[model samples]
Target: MYRERAIRLAGAVRWESVSAGDEPVRVLPDGCLDLLWSSGRGLLVAGPDRTAHLSVSAPGERWVGLRLPPGVGPAVFGVPADELRDRRVPLADLWGPTAVAVADRVADGRDVAAVLEEVARGRLVAAGGPDPLGAYLAGRLAAGGPVGAVAAEVGLGARALHRRCLRLFGYGPKTLARILRMRRALALARAGTPLAEVSAAAGYADQAHLTRDVRDLAGVPPGVLLRA
Candidate 1:
């Protein structure tokens, strides 16, 4: 497995990915936005204009995941998070011409960082926003840093914060928390920690709760992912 720092390219963004076997399975739930362009292998995607579930079962050894930063997604894909709920769009369609251009640039030996900066800036320029809520939620998600008290710290009532988050982040606060928590759990599991300890440390109610979350979000039992 590897973790590489990536920057957005001119007209697009990229994310660091960690993978396993030649044909590893990846399961992602509703939340986050991306525009992926792949040559081969198809995926099963669920959800609509707000949330989505994607399952990739592939025989190909190569997989790349691009995670669009909050506001930047709608600008690139023309499908704002506000418009996406349970819909699943293919990477080819989502990537459009921008993806092709970026790939060509990358292949031409241009600096990835410089290319990403140009891409990001171009999109930001096109997408004008008075997006206070989106800005607030992005900062909150970053600073929340794996805690349930993000709402309280922001001085928002739980219910109000929940609604605001839905509009801004395209997912409820609880769902975001579960996603973050499960992500941490997956890391701990991969690091060889015991399941019970991982569950407690990751703040799940119990091992069973952790298992369920993993199953739902990752489409695999905790045991299976850990061993991978």
Candidate 2:
């Protein structure tokens, strides 16, 4: 089974363990990035995705990952989030010898999550933490606020907000909002809420709106995704 736990780190939401299974798992966009380590594949970085990611695992393969909260990834990774958008790159490519050292530590069977967290914490501290405005924008957008309103609240104009979002989230504010809304709807639906209520409560215009979004972002309808 898959397991996840919250960890104490700025911009890090949790650590996760993905179970090895016969079938692949569909990971939907959640406006976040991940630093992942696999028993056989070493270390990799999962970028912010605009659509569902079909993750496959070999038999007996185990995986550990740290999910970074929105707007926090760029600072920790030392690049604009768009640079890694919709891609998984070898950690060595980004971190050089540091990634190799991390792989060695993982091979030693130490707590992979803790190692990854320490690495991220070090980078964030060196970088002076995430941008306060970006963090504020992320929070407001994830809360289902309108993009225009969020920008205004943060004292940013529309164009300025778009630029900041592209740098921090790898996409525009509208796209980020869409992804966050889909995540909210899915969480509610998986918890056994009816589609109609989920659509309304998640800020969609109607069930059809929710359905279209689910299909577009997740590559499946809500029913199929939930069943999976």
Candidate 3:
């Protein structure tokens, strides 16, 4: 009971879902953050996660979300990404009454997803939009660039790049790279490709390497995620 569509926002997507049953949903980490509205919770934010998140839903609860790409979240949320890592905070907690006003609009029969998109667009503009550095760093790491080499490519030292990643992506370059690699490997595996080939194609040393990394970040083996 979930569906999503790409929106005009850069690298962002709008998604809606309804809880179908009582089972806890397995939400894998994807190096992104989400602006969320729950029927019960109103306005909320989902931070980047370092590990898998088990989402327990009340039956038929509706959810609307605007997912911002990794670096884009820090720009829109106006908080360092690390502070919200693995956490879901009420939007009011950060924006105070301004967020409550946004919640009120959505609750008043306005288009839920559209309201979220409008708010995000407004905030992104005020913040001067997303930083170019974040996109470059994330892109390089996701493309299998070596951490040190990529850091240098950005004219940043290791520690400096690490600091920037913490502020922008809620993790260091190394961890972000691992997460990106895990996602890539999983996507290939889900395409019915063999794990061995997936590992090689996704830049892992071998199948065992892929298994360990996936289990570490996602809290499950490759087969488990595929079946889910």
Candidate 4:
């Protein structure tokens, strides 16, 4: 079972899951960072993924996570997003003693989700909050704004924007734009929109284009994901 809800932290979500060990769960690229606690794996951080991550779980294992959106994670972790891309690392690797303290609390059987949220909130506050540019960049790309236009909108030239994107999003603007587009299409398709219409509404040239893009990043066709 899986469930999620918006939390007090801005643009962040709290989620919990009980993995049944049925099959590998396909984790799509969503330009986000997750602070994760798995009963089987202890505490870890899930970095921004450029492609799908197949997570195989042990039956009855429990997990709780706080997902911090895009640019916010770099702030919370005090590391560039690119440094952590497509990787899941033990929290102690980065947070060290701080993460160990949290692990002790988890061992004490506290509400792990709440604890994760508190950790994220504390780090975000100490870092003085997520970069304002992050929200703007993600919002614009999600809305289908062209990359050049977005860079210009933010008073940055092309190269500067690319550098910032790598540091903040783990990818350049073009890749981020593609991932955001496919995610929007996935959302629409999951909502029961017809595939053809989903492609059109998502600004794809056709359903075939959507299929190729989805397969490239998600490692499966849209039909498969919809079934999952």
Give the best candidate by lDDT.
4
Error of 4 at 59 (Å): 1.3
Residue 62, candidate 3: how far off, in angstroms? 0.6
Q: Which lDDT value does model 2 have at 87?
A: 96
lDDT (10s digit) by residue, model 1, range 36-153? 3333433211222322244443443343445554434555455545555555565345556766677677557665445545654575567663245554565455433433567666
After superposing candidate 2 on the true structure, give the runs of residues whose Cα lies further than 4 Å from its correct spot.
Answer: 18-21
lDDT for each of the candidates? 0.56, 0.87, 0.92, 0.93
Off by over 4 Å in 3: none
lDDT of 1: 0.56
lDDT value, candidate 2, whole model? 0.87
Q: Per-candidate TM vs. native?
A: 0.63, 0.95, 0.98, 0.98
Candidates, ranked, lDDT: 4, 3, 2, 1
Give the CA lDDT, 0 to 100, for residue 187 in model 3.
86
112-164, model 4: which lDDT tens digit per residue? Answer: 88889988999999999989999999999999999999999999999999999
* Candidate 3 global CA lDDT score: 0.92
* Clashing residue pairs for model 4: none
Give model 1 RMSD, 1 decimal: 5.6
